[model samples]
Target: MNTSIPLAASDAAATSPTTLIYWFRNDLRLDDNPGLLKACQKANNLLLVYCHDVAAWQMTRWEVPRTSRHRQQFLASTLADLAMQLKSHDSRLLEVEGPPAELLPALARAIGATTIYCEEIAAPEEQEEVAALRAAGLTVETVWQSSLLDPTDLPFALDDLPDVFTSFRTTVERHHVLPPPPLARPQKIPALPPAYAALVEKWGATKGAISSGFADAEPIEHQASNSVTYRTGGRSSFPYFLPLFSGGASAASEHLHQYFDRKLAHTYKLTRNGITGVDYSTKFSPWLASGAMSARQSYAVLKEFEAAHGANDSTYWIWFELLWRDYFRLLHLKYGPQLYRAQGLTSLPQPSHDARAFDAWCQARTGESFVDAGMAELSITGYVSNRLRQVVASYLIHDMGCDWRAGAAWFEAQLIDYDVYSNQGNWLYIAGRGTDPRNGRRFNIQKQAHDYDPDGAYRRLWSAQ
Candidate 1:
């Protein structure tokens, strides 16, 4: 539950003073970001900041770090590029090290910022951070910007959203509800206060500076040209990951252009279930997960593609997938913390957790060839194809009889494209604890391997690894 009270836009405009802080969370890009534009419009002296929380690196109860080295490297690349983008607009992302509730309030007080603007995240941990900021007496304004369709535009309230995806999709389509076009990136951003850099200097002098691996104690300079080089900094077992898809708005935009420019979307439905190679899918999840690309931005581009190439099942299916992502987000809002519980939305008996079985599955020694291949692929690379994700998750819950939460946690830790709402929702769905009309998703592993990888090439390739 989010405890922060909503602040009206007019109130924000009326009461805003000189200094403003725009805290970037999941929405890392400049374009199509309403909160960022509001920050730019409201601030006379703007300070842009992003906090890298230490909690993200800590180990979970499942004995895995909450985030992976590959994901961190991708994030580092994204932030480096985002910092450069901000620099292009006379601002820089003051890459701070600490909890946002701690660092943001201190920085806001130091710079005398009256308002803090950010994207609203509905997840439990993220919600607590926002609540903490409000409790600290910051005038925090948040926009519900993650979904393709705005909550206000929905035909029904979020609490009334249908449990099943099909019903939700039908209602939304019947209402003719659509997402508005994305906002453009600002041409120029407000300059940081000259005295603002002195806070870090003061902190360094007092030995109170937070040790963010990405932050430097030097004054954050806002330059005309971006000087930072984009590199996936940390070591990763998934060498095949980042090169295939880099982070930040630049890469996302370029990929969108090339994907539609080549008319690849026409065959999306045909190859979306494929288990190997890049051309099998659009591969936009990584960018979408990090907020480097907005859903509305993707939808707008998708509409343009439809206009130029004519609407087809493939294009419609692309929209369907986006809607599914939106449905998970809405479901999170409707269910709140129930979405994270072991029982989920159902009254099903809690599944027993076996740490030893989970360990074997995680290490790819399950001896189930297809499951092993999928797990091995995920273990070696921080990514798995959608078909493989379903297969692996089903095997974990149904075949191995392990708890779904452990599998969900592993996915959270490992995937470069982990979105909390979607990951947890999908896990619960597979475990029969969530929005499933039938008995939930249980794939026949051997049959799946035969149908998708008859040649056994994918199994052979990943099993060797």
Candidate 2:
């Protein structure tokens, strides 16, 4: 599901409205959401549900919490904003906790829902969730909405997708493929059935009320036991503590428009790699990752800015980065579960794990200033510059001699903008397990520090804590 669907009112599903559920996964915004739009058209009365997967709160094999407080706080804010928008549209959101397989089916049976609609996520775990729902006797229809370019518009079949990103990018540009224009926010959201609303209320759950106990400060695994104080000095590159940077559609929209109004995209390529600033990079990943913003929405605005102000190499580079995101996603569709293999698509041997070194790296005590600074920023701020992400990731894999999967798991647990496709793809690329012709990427930390942080400002910025 790597394409945009133009949902039409005259479609077969819209012939007559039926009782259905709309499960909000990664695509959270009401704008340009083909899946949700279809649900709005096809549903007589829809139950808009978002499930907080229990596994996200539990510990991983690395003995770290599956998610950090920073990620949860941003998520809470995103869900809160989404609920508000839904409310203004005469609809509401139901926040439930538990696996979608268990919670959704019970709700459907309880409310007599005929179908469930959601955006298609091509990753293995997300695919499994959809399968589990069907196994439990529910019909789920997923629309592809994440990728910028539609799969049908691609010049090559997915199986023939280039193994290298440069080739993929060049081919896409040569063909002039473009994203479907972003759709407007839905004017109306169908009201919830009285019976369905009563049933959930009787169960002691209402809009904005959790159906399960998922508090923001739930006890974590090792980080809690060690009395680790998760705090930042408010100097983060992408600080979520501030209201302007808060999660959800409103902030995302404000940030998006202001970014262009300030004409930041003109210098995006030059400043995107800066280590210590708020506006150095686009900082859209947090919203983009949380589904609070859509990639198409961002691109449409970029094009609008270009139309008014004109385009340049910097503006072109912005789209280049977007293509990289789409490449990771299309890779999932082409290779499927192979991308999750320990050796990835290559025949490389298993990566060895060094628990002690890995733990030191996670705690920001790796004895390497550059890597430690980056790791510290990630742990406390849940956000790091893209350059530092590559640097710290390379250090953990090639220098610390740890399993790449452990590093990926730690990132999944900590990073607020963690996308399954990008996290896994980047780790595999750095570990030499993926389709890299060079096999692996090993950064010279000293040179990187000199090139990116010549005055040691970034290192000192994170050192005091």
Candidate 3:
């Protein structure tokens, strides 16, 4: 029942040389990566490379920078882990800070690599980079490893995709196009070229820039000055949801095993909306967003759980959420440029933009106490409850009438688990221009605040002024 796919003949041929390059992008892990596996199968020698595009960090149409420190910290941790993993396979991840378009191909040439293997990204900038690499005459092979459902196996073509999520979901479910099982980690990694040592040394001296667009109250001061304990990166992140589940892939796998084996899937429907603590929701999004876990792996575990424990509404709901994730990703692939436009996809009523109002929202100085608190929480912790995300997004689009793109950009800059598809899709949905049939369905801000935070506990924690 595995659905994993390998590269095409031409792509395989490109990697048939003595040395091949595996460029790590969003698919950061050593496990279940088709591109990495394929590269391992084809090459006798391999060079792993990661590029931090400085231009991407600095370029901003909105006020915020693209890569926030929170995301950078997470990425840095993951890269460190990835390097360790690669070392076991006899390869090392070469970290570089430059545009991939120029740097990747140049690095490939420098190391005498005939082929490049990497994950495929549908974003505009990534697509341009791919084109640039092809134009440079290197054999570039891309594996579609990002989504739960492969686009080629989708029920309908991208252009003909249903505008509504339910329609897309129904059609896919009816077609029964289940995702393939996750790929296993490759057993042996190829050796690096002798010259790669020099390239690695050159990149080692480059330091990552810290941007103010995504700063926080300094961590040391937060702990010492206020007697407040904050969970920093690494293993501490999952512990915050203590007594529920562990963090990282090993923890995620164990949680999946227990949920299926112990019939916890049956209870998910009852607890998914709970406001506080770990068991409330799956807590899989952060891991899934970063490629630490794969949608297919989660699905396989759920299916096994259902087979053993019996399927029910709770089991179905997990798939429902995963399908929603897939639907949003497809929407991104389908709309492409339109999704990035100021007006979004729908020809609906537009919001009024006032710089002063927008500035207030960004600065967490908005007059509404609840929305202001949520914004501040987002600024300081890089994490927000799903309830608050919808509430704050509604407040930004409906009450303040700010441009949705601005708000989406702010989330992109702030969220630690910001996936381009989910961030943009959710924003467009709130703005009434995405998959929603009813355009601009605004949430009742006051009612939501009262219902979700009746005692104002969340507000008290985050309200700056």
- For all candidates in order, the CA lDDT equals 0.81, 0.85, 0.74
How well is each residue in 1-465 modelled by candidate 1, as lDDT tens digits?
999887899877677657889989989999999999998887788888888787876777988667765576678778878989887777767777768888888888888875799999889998999999999999999988889999889999888999889999999999999998999887678888676678656532211332233222111121211221112122222332344467888888988889899888999999999877767788888889999999999999999989888989999999999999999999888888988888999888888888899998888889999999888777655778999999999999998889999999989887888998899889988999999898688999989999999999888877555
Q: Write the per-residue lDDT of candidate 2 for residues 1-465, one digit (tens) a residue.
A: 869777786775566557889999988789889999999887778889998887787777887777777787688789889989998898888877678988889888887885899999998889999999999989999999988888989999999999999999999889888998988886778879667666556542433443223323222322331232334545767767677888899999999999999999999999998988889999999999988899999999999999999999999998999999999999999998999888899887888889999999888999999998998888777889999989998999999899998999989888889998899999999999987779899999999999999999889988845
Error of 3 at 289 (Å): 1.7
Which structure is stronger by TM-score: 1 or 2?
2
List runs of model 2 lying over 4 Å from the truth.
1-17, 202-231
Sort order, lDDT high to low: 2, 1, 3
Q: Candidate 1: misplaced stretches above 4 Å?
A: 1-17, 200-244
**lDDT by residue (tens digit), candidate 3, 1-465:** 979799899987777657888888878777788999999888877888888877646636666667665565555555666777787777787888778888888887888886899988777777888889999888899988878888899878899999988888889889998888888999888888788878877664244342322344222222231232343222122332332332245444666666566666788877775544546667677667767678888898888878876889988999998988888888878887688776788676566777778778877888887888777766655666677788889888888878988888888877767888888889988998777887766888789878877898767766553
**Clash count for each candidate, listed in order shown:** 0, 0, 3
Q: Which stretches of candidate 3 lie over 4 Å from their true place?
A: 1-17, 205-264, 348-351
Better of 2 and 3 by TM-score: 2
**Cα distance off (Å), candidate 3, residue 77:** 1.5
Candidate 1 lDDT for residue 233: 21
